[model samples]
Target: MKEISDSTIVDVHARRIFDGCARPSLEVVVTTKSARVCAAPSYSDPRSSGKYEIRHFPNGGVQGSIDLINSIIRERLIGMKADSQEEIDGLFLDIDGTEGFENIGGNTAEATSMAVAKAAAASLGLPLYEYASLNREIGVPHQMPNIIGGGATMGDEGWKGRTPDIQDHIILAVGCQSTYEEMLCVSDVFHRTGILLQEADPNFTGGRDEEYCWLPGLDDVTCLDVLKQACDEVADARGVAFRLGLDVGAADLWDEEKGVYVYLKEGIVRTPDEHATYLASLIDHYNLFYIEDSFFEDHVELYVEQMQQYGNRVLVSGDDLLAGNLQRLEKMAGRCAINAAVIKLNMAGTVTRTRKFVEMCKKNGFSTIGSCRTYDSPDDTMADLIVAWGCNAYKCGSPAGGEHAAKYNRYIRIDKKLGEIPTFATFPGVKP
Candidate 1:
């Protein structure tokens, strides 16, 4: 092996496109001094993969990452010693295995993976995830993100199935998804059929369409009506039972002063401290599964208090609270800060780091959800990861688009594939 020096070659680039599928996707390549190290990854939303692609870089995250690598490629090394990649990889231990990637620096999984991966890429000549997962069979794992919108028709409980590998969920809007009128319809159907419908996810987190749709005020007339209409239509169409949700991620109900919950930009202002009581009421009145970041990140303790008071009925969740950072999640979970957390992959560059966050969440008795990002859809790897994490409750829809359907479809396959799910739906250990 050799150490970094001015003379070490850093040339060569190769790439391939792994077709997309019902879930997430990936396009990538690898490089070496002057040869092809490996092939591209395989997984995509085959139809919509055109929406996303990976290349050897005319310029992008991958390319920019390489630039960063080049900058750090020097110094610390004292010789023109041409080193083998395995040897270069061995150097990671000397540096605490944490370098490059400031996006979310909390755990060892991400940073270590990043460092070793770069060496492997330098060795095998492949991109990150692709290279890291090289040669490993990439199977079509299941992905489900069922957003329970139509409250009464869907029911208070959405799903409580035997999880395959992973099963996490997101119960969309409470005002619309958990309206009393809708819950009764769902409950009646569940009672009549003697089916559990879907069990309310203790990890239920909330979301909104603010970033995707136009909702000026969460409590406004038009917004409230729109929310109800959205749920009403789903209940009529899907004819399935669902659960109530709290999607603070939508930030529509965001008021820095008043804190009363708003679905859209409902014009209610509240301090972080002001909102907890109202949120507590939202849970008590609706039997809500969860309220995510009822206030902003600064209000972590307030939300923690909400969980402290009523965690039994509803789990207070966090998305922005940790931003999918393993280290931050470590601190929060260690402190028993909140009841649940959301796992968003893109917040960190690669999947390795994300998994660490999931694992930590499990250790802390923290609940988790498989989430969708603001990016393009049809990438089912996320769905696979979700199922792998054993998170049943999902959030993969906003009334339209293949991205949502793609993951939802994956969930359908999971149930179909597993034959029958086991009981005891908890993260952690062996089969119950």
Candidate 2:
């Protein structure tokens, strides 16, 4: 790789673009000595977003983020070395001068940071993953594709304000021999699951949530049942094994004033203990391989209880709970009893911070799962990130759409170049 120097950078630019969800998002371009690379920021649903997160470009929208990047950020970063990711990211923090990126915007900083990384990788004639990490023996991550969607990602037009509170119903392709096989398994399950839902409800309307899961007028439990049936059928037919997972994004359903988890569709509310018990029952009943945000983000006690009860049987992962923050992860390291952490790049503001969180997870024996935002672009950056960091799993929505398939396609290319068979992780409920 080429050494980074002051002359490595030429210019920096930021602009507004529409993401896959047709929402305003920031795209940053970094011009280097040899290449120009562009990066688009990801978006998380506000309900499930971390309390500490910046206000999505200060409510200035894409234009505000673009203004900061093109002016102040550009002035500061114009002559810096693209390879100095930590220093470049530090400049973002220094300029923002706020803890949650309140000034410049987390999305803006992240887009610029990511674009710089890509530029540096290109200048060195290396892939982004390789430039980020020198290790070449990184394991190919298993796919955790969403099979059902609800909560914030669901549109109100379909179900007339009655949607499952749970955010995502995911499936882990546990028994696949390679990433290619895992992709096939997930694709089959995704389509078959949709077909099953359509058959079950002639009034399904074929409406899809953000992740493209069929938005049927079903309760949470019914959704799980449908997912289980579909996975079972697909596994049996394909001669492969699969396990279920859930990203409840429970913070979205928490009724702050009522102090309970409100299941509007079921017309029920559960206190913290009641909610934990319900989740435990679901995990046991379905033999769930993974469960994320089973409790609200700040509900540390409930997280600990679930981990104590089912940590040995499942990956009690934290997405909203940790929110890609090292401080939160450290605070909950041994206390919360979580077995896994979801690592999202934009949530941490920069690649340096994201990698730091990943290292923290490793040091504490927490398996890291690289995750994409709720509103992702066609960029497959997270795909390379997980492989480079050797995360245990990668979640980039369902296997159908081009936006989702881009990550899978990138992984296939990476796997081929590596000239080694991709290995799958050994988790609970998978046959040996």
Candidate 3:
């Protein structure tokens, strides 16, 4: 067995920083006897988030979270072992003493927990991912980059009196052997998709949403068609295969009061079953490799039905449905018909719990995808997390933007260090 270091933490510090959207967020640094590490929590768009999640930070903004971390959390954690991740995070739970981290703040707990892990990895002179897991077969996750945008991320400004209910239209480079190749394939598709959009609409302006998803004046189905045509063109030109994915974020369209999904742009309403059938048809029509949150978080039965019907053909995934919570994940484990779960570390409030959730998913034969927030800081921690724990897929928006590029750059660095091209996951068995 390899000997691990037992470095004791000497200090903990907290500060306020701005995320991608200039929203207030908390950042923390943990110092061990030999090294130090820092981290910050990312935020999701309000419309795309789960209904049951705790307050992102305390109501007082970043200052409140920093105050709690400095005054209450620091002293308790300073003398603990940095290498003991579970113990450090357990102390966070005890200090907060509230479900969903309503007291000390989820963002604070997440920043502190991740900082300690990074400090421990630094102390051991190992990469963050290597320190986090014993598995050496950590392959590169398939990259899903958003090519089109709609719903909450776009708001009402760019829709031109029409609202597309779907959240994101993404692309998958399924047949690429390495991260570099996958990136090239997606980049080509992104540019080609843009050219096609510009040609189709004479008044089209080059505008994008927060995640760099193209803001085109087209309905959901029309956007999918455009993306598919772009993918076909890119594949033929580059000699690589690609597929389409959707982050439907169905909760954004669900009407809790009326018990129907209101597609304001299409001018139609759908019950759970009608919505499921419509989504299934879309999957078949576009040959979608991944579909996320086809139903709202509370609609477990509907999710199960979709999973049963299409899990074999597509990655029936949950983002809003799971929201990185252990109890919710456990509820969907065997009972719900999901084949994959999106793991966003901060949403779970700690790296320890996030790993536990990934383990739970693996045990239940579900693939795990490490995902980033739409409103994120310029931190590459998620890049390390995905590689370190060996997730099956990764989603961090387009290759543009500093926040998104940070993740892609980290993966490129990792690939360079390995000196060997890493294998990528193939969904739907990569049709001929």
Candidate 4:
């Protein structure tokens, strides 16, 4: 067993069919066959509107920017040795130079690049993580069980037809138990909504072919009980430090009257502001790790107050605050507006931009977390980024979308490669 030679690159075409989206794809692995690789490998999910997303190409011919992914990628990838992390990264840089930021806005370059990595790993007979600088001591990542309600504001184009920027939050709770099992269950409210959850805009319902998810109605007391039970089970099985999270999604939510943010809206979930204290209390009670869109977007004062009070209890993350843009996050940070921010790929428009956003947030003492939209598939490219770029946490959704499953699989691969990581993964001196 020896280091893979940089002179050799492997090209292998692959196939993936998940959540009803099936197509033939290509993956290129660049590494030497002689590398004493521990494992040569490896590695999901979604979009917001019609403008984003790379469709599966079963016939091998797809339209849009995806067609820009040339078979030339195979040419540049072949004969590369996976001797070190720097070497592989350098390879990517060189390929990308000719390719040049081709994989932005759900571009096809993403699909092609992902496939190439997989092929390169297999060519070397080394696990993808091993050759790709994977750490083999990190145990699989753990996510807390908190329901997320996805509410979208409907109506209007500009300010004229623009209905309120609010959404109906239907809680979709994630479950992880002592048996190392993580399941996502919805409340009775979503159950009642039935097909309505799937019918977001009705006129513009994306992922029309995928299964719809929503929260069924339930009393706050019942929802609380369910949440507590799930929390208890997850904490006991995994470590309490594993983490819990929530996303209210404030872009569709707003508040000009209450002077509060969008999280206080009624008929969504948790009974508006009535449960703010209760929710905060629970967060404190359970040592919750992260909270997103808690008080709506742009409610700087509300967030300031939450941070002042709960700063020592949990991490209050921001999504709409920065809308996945670093410049916005920096502005918000300068104003002392948030503790954490979400990294949405489309929001940044490209992987390059997204990386900059993550870097900027980290510079400002913020944790960068990866996330997914409701509409998704078996594409784990983002999941791959989460590991490669080292996100604090990832919200790919309740294992429903094969996208979730795909990401979960990638995480498992990471854990297998890296081993178990130190339990010292907390906010640390941040007082969160």
Candidate 5:
């Protein structure tokens, strides 16, 4: 039997692979004395990458990231203890020397960091989640799947220059007895929404966006209406309750020079105050369970106001506003800006750092939702990460393709492995 104490990293390998978008991306393999493990980081479109996020690639493309990992990174890590995650991650920060990790790509460093963690866990004969959790108790995570997409993710495909202003419309199976039941509830709503869209629209292309979410080409409000109808039907059928959520992705709509949010597809623009009012209307009308990034990243005051007005009943969360950075989170938390946040592993660039971000959110009494990027890898580490950390929810987008399904399928496996169903996680003052 191998022990983590005796295991050391023997080799590090980095290579280029295609992400779900068929775009070049980074993958890393770590060989320890006891086990070999691999991992890849999620990728995002350069346009949508958070302002505080580390660069995904340098000038040399994916190969540039690969070279740095194979050369200097590998040299520094060759003989290090595989279990020393914090120390190893610290080395990555020191080597990069940039707050944004411009030297070694974030994707490269994140993948390498995850691979090492997995290798260490295997060396100790433990599952990655069990290893990372450090024996802390965790519960089954509720799934947050995007049922519809618009805005940047929708692009101009079949829309003829018209698409919803929001990026994602999602449904949460609020009260499920088990992870399997939650999966069934969400899946039913997702498929039912698609069928209803087809029947209601003559121009329905049966098209889906990059994340495999249906692109109905309807306006944001209409899309929400369709989603609510689908959720209502599913609830009636299964005797389940569902909650709605949105990734407004307002940063994409922010027109910096104009000092307003430009809804290009809708041909309307709104000042910061107007935008917030518009969002509030949606929340009230839909009784939204969650709303993410309702303002541009820099508009912290608006976030505070929104949270104050709706935080009790809704998850007024941040994604672009938080970007999974501790400093950003601190600033927001100091202002009591949000009630929930979206945590992505690559956003912080290491397993240790990502875990720290989640912990910090917990410390501030904020809900954490582990998320997947638009251009994600097929890697299922997020399943283990969210479970290990006990996040309130997991969002991987509709489970329409392999990349998305990988995480959901892994969650089911983990549930079966534990042989017990965890109670659903809920927002404050909300019951499942």
Candidate 6:
């Protein structure tokens, strides 16, 4: 066996790059004795509510992150084994020496950590997913593509009018047996939905959000209805099952001081109990496969109630609620507050931390959704992460845009390389 020490790091470089959303982001390159690799960290919209996210721009600009990585981070990482992921990551934490990466910045840590992992894999002459899998089975996860946009993703600058109160109206290719099939399923519905949008409003000018999801001037229910129609058409045409999912992102709609969920565009206000009831109604009416963050992060009781009612059938998931923090997942483990979670590597700050979060989810029997950020990087390492972590499903937004397509295309390549197609993951007690 080749010694991991043979791939010792020699040099490190960092630079500022524009993310998918045109925001400043950090990318890092690590040169090892045996190989060289680079990676960029994905970023969530700063507007999106998350309680545990590390400080993204620690030095006020992306340039500060670049400087820190090139100087202190590089100095520390030199001569360290690229395959010593845990030790190197520990060094990163110790160097920062603050909770939530308050000093070094999570983006800097994430970019550096991923670059090291890739370097290790390259040095070993193994595929990234195979190396990261840690001797576990590499499975192909189903795709969760956003088909409609709302909330923070939608803005008043372009389209005819405001979008629904929900943040992301997504679709799951639950019935597809292969990642390639899932891509086809998602893309079919996405294009059909666009056609339907154009028909619904003659003024619909192909407006979209950062993720390339359609921005139609429709209410939440109407968006769901349109999505359902498109999915139904594709299901009938392809003879496969497709399911609807939602990211209510209730944090944005939550009026904390007033103690109510406000829907400015829909012109409605819902109390906590009322909002729970409304969500239940949608679950029944639409038969949704997943519902994420229907209640705000602090509303553990509401999430518990939702889990109790539909946890077995629906993936009552947490994004803002859990915030990809292991501690938060632990608090909700036995409480049954959530049965699923969204795993964004940036939210966790390091590759080791993200793997720990995924492990905890498995221990609690919670499905994981490897998700992309609103402001994502072109790096397709997330696709490899999905396979390595054995995520049940993954979100790469719509399958159209370059950033999104990069992930899907990479996953498809991995799926093809695997000798046999992996079994598709589905919600408990749900057919699709």
Predictions: Cα RMSD each:
12.8, 2.1, 2.2, 8.5, 1.9, 1.8
Error of 3 at 394 (Å): 0.2
**For each predicted model, how many residue pairs clash, with residues at least 3 apart or on different chains?**
61, 0, 1, 53, 0, 0
Local distance difference test, each candidate: 0.40, 0.80, 0.81, 0.45, 0.85, 0.85
Please estimate how well model 5 matches the true structure, expressed as its whole-model Cα lDDT.
Answer: 0.85
The all-Cα superposition gives candidate 1 an RMSD in Å to the true structure of: 12.8
lDDT tens digits, residue span 1-432, model 1 = 233442243432222222222322233222323332322222212211111121211134333433333344323222322233333333422333433233212111122223333444455443332443334432222122222232111111221111100111233322222222233443233232211111222222332221122212122222223333444555565564334455543233344455544322233445555556655665665555656655556555676677678666566677667766666677777666677777765444345556667778777776676666443345444555565555534455342345554655555454444444322134222110
Model 3 has an lDDT value of 0.81
What candidate 5 gets wrong by more than 4 Å, as runs, is 1-6, 156-160, 428-432
Q: Which ten residues in a row have the lowest lDDT in candidate 6?
A: 153-162
User: Which sections of candidate 1 miss by over 4 Å?
Assistant: 1-26, 29-100, 103-240, 250-264, 420-432
Candidate 1 weakest lDDT stretch, 10 residues: 159-168
What is candidate 5's lDDT per residue for 1-432, written digit by digit as tens? 233555699999998888998888888999998889989888878767666777776668788888999999999999998899988998998999987778877777788899988988888888988888877786778898999988778754355247677889988887677888889899999999999888766689788888899987577888888999999999999999998989998888888999999876677899999999999999999998888989889898999899889878888888888877899999998998898889987788888899999999989888889899989989998889899998889988785888988999888888878777665555544442
- What is the TM-score (0 to 1) of candidate 3? 0.94
lDDT of 2 by residue, 1-432 (tens): 456563388899987777877777778899987898988888655744766555557647679888888888899988788888889999888998886887777788888888988898888888987877666457787888887888767855345337667888989876676788889988898888888888776777677887777677788788899888888999998899888889887887888899999887888889988988888888888888889988877789888888888777688888878877778889888695598889898888888899888888878877788888878888887777788877888887778767788888998888777765765544333232
* Per-residue accuracy of model 3 over 1-432 as CA lDDT, tens digit each: 233545788889998888877777768888888897888888655666787666577767679889988988899987788888888889988988886988876778888888988998898888887788666667677788888887777754445236356888988886676788888889889888888888865666877888877877777898898888999998898898887889998888899999999887788899988998999889999988889988888889988888778777688888888878878888888685688888898788888988888888877778777888888888888888888777887888776778888898888788766657776543322231
Quote the positional error of residue 142 for candidate 1 in Å. 12
Once fitted onto the true fold, the runs of candidate 2 whose alpha carbons sit more than 4 angstroms away are 1-7, 156-161, 425-432
User: In model 6, which regions exceed 4 Å deviation?
Assistant: 155-161, 426-431
Worst 10 residues of 4 by lDDT: 36-45
Which of the two candidates, 3 or 6, achieves a greater TM-score against the reference? Answer: 6
Error of 1 at 325 (Å): 2.0
Candidate 2 — which pairs collide?
A: none
RMSD of 4: 8.5
Which residue pairs collide in model 6, if any? none
Query: Could you tell which candidate, 2 or 4, scores higher by lDDT?
Result: 2
